[model samples]
Target: MTTTQKYAATGAWNEPEGATPRGTVALLPGRGETAASYARLGRRLAADGYRVRYVPVTLDDIADARAAVEELLADESLPAPRVLLGSDSGAALAGQFVAELPVDGAVLAAIALPGSAHGEVGADWADEVDARTACPVHRAVLATDEEFARGAIASPLPWETIAIGAQDRPTLALHGTDDRVTPLAPALEVYARAARTDVRLVQGGRHDVLNDVAHRSVAATIVLFLESLRLSPEAPPIVTGLG
Candidate 1:
């Protein structure tokens, strides 16, 4: 089914089909990224029985993005369990709401791995720009957005004020081993500091694991992770074996 829909300032919506949805997923794209970048990821989520919503995000659009998330939560057609997902810098944005937010779970992908914050991109940043998407065709589609992509966004310490007890919520941090944009080490550090955190490192995967060559594997892992969250608290852990 066609999941894309129009919303304020480039559209943020949820697409649900067939039977009751497994859950609602609100996706936030990283800086230099727009909702268009999420076309592939959103489709995958919807196909897996999820009501997917792409929370439009950019440097100055965070407030709008939060509002969009709130709007989706209040949606009557959607299901109970909700997952918030963000990529790269957008992951930081999604992380900020772990405390009082109504969401059940969260996934931070290719997040600016915990590390010293720097403004300038590395020298090879340009050469590897398209490497984020394992599929050359998808990379070309993403390039349209990158050309007009926003400047580098900031990544403040996401764990600093994560509400003392918010650690109870399930959080997944995923990163590609070869992610030059956001190194894997820092993301590992973020997971290390979490309470019930599961980390997945996609071997040879680049920054855009959601749209990478191994995106199916990453998305499947995501499905299992979200499924685990919807289960009873005492359920066995999800064995992604995606190290």
Candidate 2:
């Protein structure tokens, strides 16, 4: 409850007091995902002595996001190595960003990889949404979010990002065994193509693993992954442009 909160019209940032943060996480929300959607998860991560900056996604978010990531990397107050954390469609953006932006690492959760099918939602769209997240509270949160309600498709596209290839640093890919939105098979395929990827498939999890009932577990896994690279010395700056 002592977590410090900073807010903006489009996003929010969370940091823990007293504990020295090890690094910064430039978190990008997926299509239809809002910064508010990551509130609990951000606080959870902040509690672990890591700074979390939640950025809402816009149609042209990638370009603006690059600036954000770069700014995070430049911030003297926050520690390095810097990292990118993306969920669902945001993973697509993160994958692309990592290639052009020199960051320490990335955590892609419930990613919407290539060659995947969308989950069917009929008259029971509410139920379908419920099934997408294990957390009942998050179900309501998702339902209330204007962006989440809009149900936008993935933006900027991943075709170019995948073509650029993954970064030389650590990349963690997370998927749910039962994720129909993106599915597990294609997620594995995409991860396989990456240079250095650590993939994890959660049994019985849905597309919103980072915000699901087991979010704490997912958050913990990410913290551990980031911790592995916390002490890694900074690398050279990556050129920011289309490859």
Candidate 3:
């Protein structure tokens, strides 16, 4: 659970003691989210041999956020095959990064689409938690997180500018069938523009797919994607049907 900070409250997790590092992921937290929001995700990916650097992005100053991300990606200590992973508004930023940066790949989860009904804040704390995630632990995380903007889930994002766009890099798009903030239909439309995208939907998942109840499976899917990338940037599947 080692960490380093510079531009913002960033968090970094390294690979396990004796394992060869698989790759590096520059993670961008969703709107109103802090680096702590991804503690579980960071630890999980790191344990599986991938280095995870949670880089918090601020909408208040897009320039600063992008600069922070660029600085992290330029860090030679992180290893190659760098990937951009983002959820919610952060997912939108990942889309922008993969298109503009030199990253090898991207993972977009619960992407906040343009014109989607994410503007109205939830009625109360309990309702907000329900809309955000179904995982009890994650619920507690949000509840106690004084820094977490409680109703940001319902806040409108600049989807027209930030929504994912066509990109040449290997991309993985994840969404929840039960996502209330941004429905699946429009998100599908968004990913359809990128022919190289690998899309997966979590059953009964809420807006925060990365921290939802099926987080383990979601993380495994990401690992498989990473392994595929290790083999080739095309991300061919390593395992196939039993002979």
CA lDDT of each prediction against the hidden true structure: 0.67, 0.70, 0.82
**How does each model score on TM-score?**
0.79, 0.82, 0.91
Pairs of colliding residues, candidate 3: 118-154
How well does candidate 3 score on lDDT at residue 147?
82
Model 3 Cα shift for residue 81 (angstroms): 1.1
- Give me the candidate number with maximum lDDT: 3
Candidate 1 per-residue lDDT over residues 1-243, each given as its tens digit: 343433322434444545567888888777666667666677777777887777765545556767777776788877857888888766777776654478887888876543463222443445456446567756766666544353343333333322212377777878888776666765676667767767888998887778788888998988888788778433246675677
lDDT of 2 by residue, 126-220 (tens): 65575478788888777766656444533224343343146487888888887767767767777888877888877788888897777777888
Instruction: List per-candidate RMSD values in Å.
Output: 4.3, 6.9, 2.9
- Once fitted onto the true fold, the runs of candidate 1 whose alpha carbons sit more than 4 angstroms away are 1-16, 60-65, 113-125, 128-131, 145-166, 233-235, 238-243
Candidate 3 regions with alpha-carbon error over 4 angstroms: 1-10, 116-121, 159-163
Q: What is the alpha-carbon lDDT for the whole of candidate 3? A: 0.82
In model 1, what is the error at residue 217, expressed in angstroms?
0.3
